[model samples]
Target: MLTIKSVSKSFDNLSVLDTIDLHVKKEEFVSIIGPSGCGKSTLLEIVTGLIAPSNGEIYFNEENVTGTTNKLGYMPQKDVLFPWRTVLENVIIPQEIMGIRKKDAEKKARQLVEKFGLSGFEEYYPSALSGGMKQRANFLRTVLTDKRLLALDEPFGKLDALTKREMLKWLTTVRMETKQSFLLITHDIDEAIFLSDRIYVMSSRPGRIVKEVHVKEKHPRSNGFLLSKSFSELKNELLSSLGV
Candidate 1:
C-alpha cells in the first residue's frame, strides 16, 4: 500500500536518513526499530509528508505521494490531545478540519470511541485518563480520520511496562477487528515483534535499513507467542542487527 525508494535526508551536512527503501502491503503491519537518533521518526515524517525528503520518492497505493493525503492517518510519539477538548471533541477534530459538519463528525467519533474501548470515557478530559487510555483516545482520533493506513510514532512509548503490554494486546484486537494497515516506529524490539508482520532494523545516525526480519506469526497473536522459541530467536536477531 506504500513504498519508499532511496529516501535520504540531511540538514547542513548532517545526515539523518540514507538511501532508505521499504514498503508496506495492504492491511499489513510493519515496524522500524533502531537506537536513538537513527532517524526512524525522520523517516516517518517523510512518509507522512510532514517533512520533505532531501532525495528519493514515496508512493501510496501506486501513485506518487508528494504531500500529505487524507488516505493516511498519523499519531506522533505524544498523544498531543487538546487538554481543553473532551475526548469526543478531540476525536472529531480531524473531521472538523476536513469540513465535515460537527454533528456528523461527532457521530463518527462516538462510534470509533465505542469501538476502541473508550465509550464510557468520551466525556473525560485528556488529563483525567491514564496513559493507556490517552493513547487509545489518540488512536481513535487518528483512525476516525477515515484513513485505512496509519503511521504511528511510538504510540506506546510513554506507558509503563504492564500498561504497554495491555495496549499492545488492545492494538492487536483493534487491528484484527478493523483490518487497518499500520507502520509503527518503536524502540522496543519485543513490541515490534509482537505487532509487526515485518520488521526493519535501521543503522545509526545516517539511518539505513540494515536488515529486514519477517515475523511469521499469524494475526491475533497472543502474549504467549512472546515466550515461544521463535520469538526469542527473532528478538536476539534484531538486537544483533541493531548492535545492542
Candidate 2:
C-alpha cells in the first residue's frame, strides 16, 4: 500500500538516510528497529509527508504522495494531547481539522473510545487519565482520522515496561480486528517481534535497511508465544544484527 524508492535525507552535509527503498503491503504491520539516531523517525516523516525527502519518491496506494497528504495517520513519540480538551474532544480533533460536522465526528469518536476501553472516560481530561489511558486516547485520535496507513514513531516508548506490554497486546488486538497497515519505529526487540509481520533492522547512521526478519507467528499471539523457541531465535538474530 506504500512504496518508498531511493529515499534519502540529509541535514546540510550530513546524511541521515541513504537510498532507502521499501514497500509495505496492505494490512501488514512492519516494524523498523535500529540504534538511536539511525533516521528511523526521519524516514517515517518523509513517508508521511511531514518532511520532504532530500531525494527520491514516495507513493501511497499507487498515488505519489512525496509531500504532506491526508492518507496517513501519524502517532508520534508523545501523545501531545490538548490539555484543555476532553478525551472525546481529543479523539475527534482530526475530524474537526477536516471540517467534518461536529456531531458526526463526536459519534464516530464515541464509538472508537468505547471500543478501545475509554467509554466512561470520554468526559475526562488528559490530566485525569493514567499514562496508559492517555496513550489509548491518543491512539484513538490518530486512527479516527480514518487514514488507510498508520505511522507510529515510538508510540509506547514513554510507558513503563508493564504498561508498554499491555499497550502492545491491545495494539495487536486492534490490528487483528481492524486490519490496518502500520509502520512502527521502535527500539524494543521484543515489541517488534510480538507486533510485526516483518521487522526491518537498520544501520546506525545514514540508516539503510540492513536486514528484514519475518515473524511467522500467528495473529492474536499469546503470551506463551514469547516463550517459544522461534521468538528467542528471532530476538537473538536481531540482537546479533545490531551488534548487541
Summarize candidate 2's per-residue lDDT along 94-120 as a digit string, tens digits.
999999999999998877776788989
lDDT of 1 at 205: 92
* Residue 165, model 1, lDDT: 96
Candidate 2 has its poorest 10 consecutive residues by lDDT at 108-117
TM-score of 2: 0.98
| Alpha carbon lDDT at 104, candidate 2 | 96
Instruction: Give the per-residue lDDT digits (tens) of candidate 1, residues 1-244.
Output: 9999999999888999999999999899999999999999999999999888999999999999955656599999977899999999988988999999999998877767766879899898998999888999899888887788999999999899999999999999999888999999999999999999999999999999999999999989998999999999999999999887
Each candidate structure's TM-score, on Cα atoms with residue i matched to residue i, is 0.97, 0.98
Q: Candidate 1: what lDDT?
A: 0.91
